[model samples]
Target: MDKLLSNIKIEVPPGIYLKDPESSSLGKKIVENSIILLENIGFEDFNFKKLGQLIGSNESSIYRYFESKHKLLIYLTSWYWSWIEYQLVLETYSINDTKDKLIKAIEIVSRTTKQDSKYSHINEVLLNQIVINENSKSYLTKDVDIENKDGSFMPYKRVVQRISEIISAYNTSYKYPLTLASSVIESALHQQFVKIHFKSITNCNDEITPTEFFIDLTLKTLTDGK
Candidate 1:
């Protein structure tokens, strides 16, 4: 697991970004600093102009890597999915029992993320915050069809499919594996939003962790037992 995470260099879809942000010194700075920018200011206020100033580079240099802030957001989100998927596979791939695999898969998505130094260019903490608060904006937009057609969402979808396959292995007779998989994925993200914004309604706290909530719900939903 340590070896695999240490070797991470996730490849984003070609159409997702203008250039690979991990390719050069300037590009790496763009990826590293942009996460900071997005974290400090909300996505609505984030743009290449501000990012360029922050990185001590010009707008054209930043634009050379990303066409727009939307694309940049998509790229960042996709990179995150790819990285987490790597961790997911590393942690769960070797398990022979389907139930164990399914449980481990749920754990990967439900826990709060800690930044891995293997990918120094990306700050996992800020990326997770963006995912909870801003990532839906990338796909919830009107241009979703165009981006989907371009395969920009493939990394995230791949994560869903892997988990869905685990469900099918757990219970071939059960239906709605893919739907359940997507639900767990989206719900895990939204639960963070709920915990932060709707604390009065949520029971998530130090006693009942986000991970415990999802593991209980997912196992019961998958096996029809608590």
Candidate 2:
């Protein structure tokens, strides 16, 4: 997640940088420029100073908008999820049934995943943090009051819940609950990518894209051996 977001430039100069309560145009520019930089230099070599310099802004000015690198990382992760939600909403316009919705949803996610090169680093970082780092798992899954006092869940949990809702709409005859299927989907989505990251020796030259395989397999499973 951090790596994917590392492409975004949050702080810019007084004249060129984004101000607090960022205007949409300025914010979009910051994200676009940041992605260009990240693609060239990678995240480890990128930072506010480098970004600020590239965008004709001062480091201090950048800090004013994002505060710290940590805040910037959180913002990026949330932005990815928000974007997914928005795309799903848009795709729903063409989907009238659960089966179609599930298939469309998978296709949309797969397309977005492939096109967003920024997410490569983000996916790599998230997999490492969630599966390898004990402390990060706790933070990622820490309970929060999303709807009611008694109904609390973590950030990832909510994401999973949304995924489950989409899954549930598929073939009602299938006995397995959408929640369980969602967990399977999430595990497959995140962990498999990380595994591929290593198995390909970090070159990312795999032939069969996860999107294709996942979409086909998930549809079959959800459709009761279809």
Candidate 3:
């Protein structure tokens, strides 16, 4: 353990404080700091000068690491999706019961969204843009494939597909409707977060946790087909 720790060096940005100096993890550290700044200030207000100052690094050095702010945003967005995919796969899909599978998938997704603040914020922004962009592109292009190439496979759709697959796995013999399951799953996933954070959906005064509501509502509706 001591040898491994000794070998593991982390790069300290030019002016950043480091209790223990290491260089190996410097890139990752910068990315993490970048995410914090992005979340607090957002992409519109974020500036490389400010970020470099905060990290104790020169603007030029930061640029060397990340070509541009837009590039960083894209990388961060992709990273969030990769983490989400890992989490989705970890949920046990073959639980031998259709309802349980649906509940588990919902639980994982809600837990992931609630726990990861940066990811949750990114997901909200990207999902809204993705929906609008894809819809607009589809109208513009006569070809569905061309429309997809413009803006397709948003995270929302990925989550819905994973949830649908889990539900379908358990009901393989019965062959539940994929479209119906997808609709309920998407609604259940988005409604919980959207209602509380985006806007109060109608007159519901309850501040329910996303995971509990999603798991309960999704499982019940998907299994019973009601």
Better of 1 and 3 by TM-score: 1
Alpha-carbon shift of residue 193 in model 3 (angstroms): 5.0
- Model 1: lowest-lDDT 10 consecutive positions: 217-226
TM-score to native of every candidate shown: 0.95, 0.58, 0.57
lDDT, candidate 1, 1-226, per-residue tens:
5785577578789998778877799989998999899988989999999999999889999989989999999998998888778878889967999888888998898888998888877899999998888879889999999999999999999999999998888888778889988999899888888988898988986677777888888788867722
The deviation in Å at residue 56 for candidate 1 is: 1.0
Per residue, candidate 3 scores C-alpha lDDT tens digits across 102-166 of 66666665553434343322344443322222222222335435523544235435656676677
Please report the candidate that would top lDDT against the real structure. Answer: 1
Q: By summed lDDT, which 10 consecutive residues of candidate 3 come out lowest?
A: 13-22
**Per-model C-alpha lDDT, please?**
0.87, 0.50, 0.51
List candidate 2 segments past 4 Å from native: 1-21, 24-28, 112-159, 171-207, 223-226
TM value for model 3: 0.57
Weakest 10 consecutive residues of candidate 2 by summed lDDT: 129-138
For candidate 3, the per-residue lDDT at 134 reads 26
